[model samples]
Target: MSERLKSFIRERATALGFEACRFASASAPWDAGERLAHFVGEGRHGDMGWMETTLERRAHPTAMWPEAKTAVVLGLNYGPEADPLPQMADRSAGYLSVYARGDDYHEVIKGRLKILAGQMAARTGQDVKVFVDTAPLMEKPLAQRAGLGWQGKHTNLLSRRHGNWLFLGSILTTAEIEPDAPEGEHCGSCTACLDACPTAAFPAPFQLDARRCLSYLTIEFAGPWPEEFRVATGSRIYGCDDCLAVCPWNKFASGAREARLHAREALNAPRLADLLALDDPAFRALFAKSPVKRIGRDRFVRNVLYAAGNSGDAGLVEPVGALLGDPDPVVRDAAAWALRRLEAAGLA
Candidate 1:
């Protein structure tokens, strides 16, 4: 009966656009709570105090809900068609992380998860909950346990077929399903992901220091970027994919086919000059459906200024200089930094 139910769920998931689906016993790894306590205790989560706040519930699937007997983990591939490194060579343009180049995955993935959950409940007459990054659920570890993928050295889930470019969504249900064999670590002696990080975000092979990570600094951290990471940010204005892009496993995955995840041409490599000229209204219209919209105009512009400073395009100095009088003090501060960096390079 469990096997038949699993097959039914898999068929429904594939029909719903999920690339892969696997089930795991709805129980946390033995050390999951301890690991969370340590990660939060050391202050590695940075300003994300919510990790500490929800530690009890996030520590285990059963802790969040005792009725959950199975966890359905799903993967959706968003692999880029071409290499992402070449864009960094064009200093005049801003490089957004590939994931943010299209529609927000939270909206895309959550909507799908909700549909799957509804279908599962209807068919089985069981309770279900859906999550897609917005929740405190420990997705990567659970995905690994479900055989969706193993946690790569970079701490993101990496699959033998999808690499690390897959978006993960989870559904917890009271219905029982036979669990799949857990995927074993395949990283071996390779350190490609760890070495690829410009900020050395990984303190160890599988441990990530959120504070030094460019993605966290650009998107999650509020206020101006720390002085130490400003120069390393380069022309990346949204999020960083350095580690994910360099993974050799990506060679096996096909390019992204999900229409909503496809890159918008305008965002691929937007001119830094044009980005600097954007006021609030222009910024919103430009990034209406993209994940970049969540950062808001001030924080988004602050990132643009950081990229402009690292661009080494002396031409950008004037445009960046214009932001000195901008209403947001954060933008003004970033402008000041960009001016000094450009002048130091004798581009002023």
Candidate 2:
């Protein structure tokens, strides 16, 4: 009966556009909680204070919901058509992360998850809950437990099938669905991800310090970044994808099947000069359905200013200089810093 139910759920999830669907015993004991606690204890989470607040509840699946007997982990592939690393060489253009280059995955995946969860509930006569990245459900660990993939050295889920470009969504249920075998770590000797990091975000294999991660700094951190990170940020105006792009597993990956997840041409390699001129309205329109919209214009411009500073393009100096008198204090500071960098580069 459990095997039949798992098959039904997998079929439903696949029909709903999920690339991978596997089940795991959510109630099973695991050490993911201990690692999370250690990460928080060391203050590695940086500005994401919510991680601290939800520590206990995020510790275990049962801690969040005692009735969660099974975990249905789903993966949606969002791989790019080719390697994104080469685009960074065009330093005059801002490099938005591959994930943010398309429509927001949260909106895309959450709706499908809800539909799949509803189907599971009807078939098994069980209560169900759906979660995207927003919830503290630790979808990566659950995905690993479900045999979807292993957590690579970069601390991101690595799939032999889909590689590093899978978006995870989970459905927790009250039904005792048969659990698949858990995936084991396959990152034996490769340190390409750690070596590729511009900010050295990984202190050790499988450990990430969010404080130093450019993705966290560019997206989650609100104010002007520390000077070191600003310089290291290069042309990356949004999230960083160096670690993910350098992963060997991506060789087997293919481009996204979902049309909405395809990269927009405007976002792929936007000119730094153009981006530095974005006001609130322009910024909102440009990133209407993108994940980048969450950061707002001020913060987004701040990131652009840093990229402008690193661009070494004299053309961007005028736009960067104009922001010096801008309203947002952070933007003004970034503008000043950008001007100074340009001056140092003999471009101002």
Which candidate leads in lDDT? Answer: 2
Give per-residue lDDT, candidate 1, residue 348: 96
Q: Per-residue lDDT of 1-348 in model 1, one digit per residue for the tens?
A: 888888988999999899999999886455767888888888899988888899999888888888888999999999899878789999889999999999999888888889989999998999999988888788888888999889889989999998888999999999888899999999999899999999999999888889999999999888888787988988989999999999999888778879999899999999999999999999999999888998899999999999899988989989999999999999999999999999999999
Model 1 misplacement above 4 A: none
- State in Å the error of residue 237, model 2: 0.9
Between which residue pairs do clashes occur in model 2? none
TM-score of candidate 2 on Cα atoms, chains taken together: 0.99
lDDT of each: 0.90, 0.94
Highest-scoring model, TM-score: 2
Give the total clashing residue pairs for model 1.
Answer: 0
Task: Evaluate residue 304 in candidate 1 and report its C-alpha lDDT on the 0 to 100 scale.
Answer: 90
TM for candidate 1 is 0.98
Question: lDDT by residue for model 2 over 1-348, one digit each (tens)?
Answer: 988887888898889999999999999999999999999999999989999999998999999999999999999999999999899999999999999999999999999999999888899889999999898788899999999999999999999999999999999999998899999988789999999999999999999999999999999999889999999999998999999999998989999999999999999899988888888999999999999999899999999999999989999889998999999999999999999999998997
